[model samples]
Target: MHTRRSLLLTAAAGSSIALLGLATPNATALAATSDQGLVDEARITVQDFTGDTQFTDMRRKLARAKGVFIVPQLLKASFIIGGEGGSGVLLAKTQTGWSEPAIYTMGAGSIGLQIGGEASEVMLLLMSDKAVEAILRNEFKLGADASVAAGPVGAGIEAATTTNLGADILSYSKVKGLAAGISIEGAVISARHSRNAAYYGKQAHPRAILYENAVSNRGTLELRQALAAAEMP
Candidate 1:
């Protein structure tokens, strides 16, 4: 059983590594620039989600969201052992407008009969102040630190929207042009302090970046614009 589990994990890691574009011999170099690339990808992800018809419910939720965390490419690999992980950016909706993004990472592992690999664009709409606050921490587990529910998509959007009001966070994801329910109940979201500092050229903390407005980067302007447009009626 132990050997089987190790094989499963190895397979899953290989898939994730490929999805991250780190499977090459030059992976070390690519890793150096991944922070900036992640931000750029995040901008594209927001634009894609807002413009896509399938994400109408997510856009609606974003109108009232206190914050948003966007994972441009969440990778999952499963074959008896399942693992999901990705790097993302988190931004707060402040009284002035959207704040600069702070880096975060999501990862989880589970045992199941699932088989296959998938990559998706994911977003977490922070529905309440509690949800936003919990995410600002150094690390937190989804469904344990804050209430979370899959955001309604397609046919059930209206009904689920009303019923999901009490959930602190609403998650939305898409893969290959179709909406997907990426199970993230036990995922850990932790701050990526080094990335945050590298991106901003200073020591930027999650709270300061999202809440205090302590730093700014011209590169992220497009991402903020996309979020603003998505929230419009």
Candidate 2:
């Protein structure tokens, strides 16, 4: 009777190990599935932002924008001495469309207590040939070297400014899903193309993805079409 009991215990342990081995692949697949969904959701968010009034205006003002870096929701923090924020996507426009997102970091060590916590959408219009060139090199700061300014807003073209710092710079803002008439200035933007590419498992830049003719899903396409209509001449 002891020998039979020992045999049964051994069989149960072996079965448990086999079951665990089978479950491993399913677990890995589930993780991959979740990540894919996240990427798709991010793309949808971009398309939604484009349709927003403020974002639409910014896009129209900078229609000729060669590169656009979009961070869906940028979290900002500030204290008495200094503050910092990191990990956003830098998307560059290509001949075809907008490129895949290149990860980026932005922060400044300054003195001030800008006590607030809000999710902001930052749009960088690369106006200088020098700025564009610098992005290709890697990641570079906006106000650190290049002149960044707040963009104007209105329905009429006359309301827009034609001033260019070797190229034109247009920026806009939105608060809690409402379009803010003011533009965001002083904030810096930089690209981390290498890290971004790694995240996407590609050797390409965000600009490449922007320009591609690939059709975003139904929701994205609809949003793009709406923004296009609003921005039409």
Candidate 3:
């Protein structure tokens, strides 16, 4: 158990360092750039996040989420105060269906009980109309404009019975052997204006893509499929 934990931490830290721009240019260049490429990458991550049997409860709740944000890979490296960052895509559950994803960036700094490096899979399910509204803005801080909590995972836990519905959003992170929940209390979620601009051929915001129903799911077939499975009642 001790050796496994050490490996998990080491792997997480390594992923974090490379993703956080602390690695060489070649390593950094491997990070997703084109919007289509990121959408493709995040789809694979979503598969990993939901594939485990342990996520049954969380997956059920995700189906009902007003909007779901997928941070495929979040890297964090720290000695005292560490920096964590990742890029991902968001899909709003429209009246019709899940809309195309809008790319976004999530970042935060921590100085608490964290010691070594960590890489994680971050997911946020917008649980309320107001919570979805809070994320549509230019820059939104978790646990401030809207409440956020780690969604319960694993078997035997009933999503409807275990969750605090008052929370606007439920967050989760799965890191290797440590597949449970983690807090993203102070993280900032922002629309990737440049990526959106380049991808859509103009300046686009989360408002226009997710809320207003301007974009369609052309390149997000896999992601939408994964979300559809999670949404199944």
Candidate 4:
């Protein structure tokens, strides 16, 4: 039984590596001149890819999410030889603006083939603060550190799902310029504070950028407007 299980694990890992080959390599470094740049890029990508119709739909869905994290780009590579893929920022809506991105990593397991490779954009909705807080840490793994469940999308949105991480979470995927029904199950997310801080050229905390303020360039005005509109008594 032990040997069989080991073989199965090896096969699953091999399959994941094979799937990643479909992604093209990008030479550009993951650096941002300013938080606004990241936010602007994310907003533009979201609008451009999702289009007015789907973008509107996503926005409405996001608005209803408890929290969202926008990472602009999530570069993922497997340790055991695999292609690399990136996902745009993870954004969570807030009374003021979206929360700063927390970093996490994910790997495919047996039973499901989290196949496909391409630098696509992704959006995650944190249904509970527990999961959100866990992401605030510098590093996190999907299956190891925290439990993750496949997020519901589109018509499946009406159904409620729970995660073992003490929070309810949902995810959606977009490739090139289209929404996909694919589940981002084995994928992980965690904070890249050292890298992110280096990009921003400051000693600022990731939370400051993800939660406290809107760091993107184009969204500053819009974020401010949103905050003003949500001003508390």
Alpha-carbon local distance difference test for all models: 0.81, 0.48, 0.72, 0.46
> Which order, best to worst by lDDT?
1, 3, 2, 4
Sort every candidate by TM-score, greatest first: 1, 3, 2, 4
lDDT per residue (tens digit) for residues 72-152 in model 1: 778888999989998889999999899999989999998889899987889999999998899888898999999999998
- The CA lDDT at 214 in model 4 is 30
Model 3's C-alpha root-mean-square deviation from the true structure amounts to: 6.0
TM-score of each: 0.84, 0.61, 0.80, 0.55
Per-residue lDDT for 1-233 in model 4, tens only?
22432343345334434534343222112233233344454454444434434444345445555565443343333344444333234445566565554333333333333454444456565666666666666654544554455444455443443332353565555654566544455555655454354344444565676676634333345533442233222
Name the runs in model 4 displaced over 4 angstroms.
Answer: 1-31, 34-37, 48-60, 71-84, 87-95, 99-117, 143-167, 211-233
Scored by lDDT, model 4 comes in at 0.46
Model 2 segments more than 4 A misplaced: 1-45, 54-56, 82-86, 155-157, 163-168, 181-190, 202-233
Q: Residue by residue across 66-130, what tens digits does model 2's lDDT show?
A: 65554444555665654544334444545545444445566544567667555555556666555
Clashing pairs in 1: none
Better of 2 and 4 by lDDT: 2
Candidate 3 least-lDDT 10 residues: 25-34
Q: Which stretches of candidate 3 lie above 4 Å from their native place? A: 1-33, 112-114
**Candidate 1 lDDT for residue 48:** 75
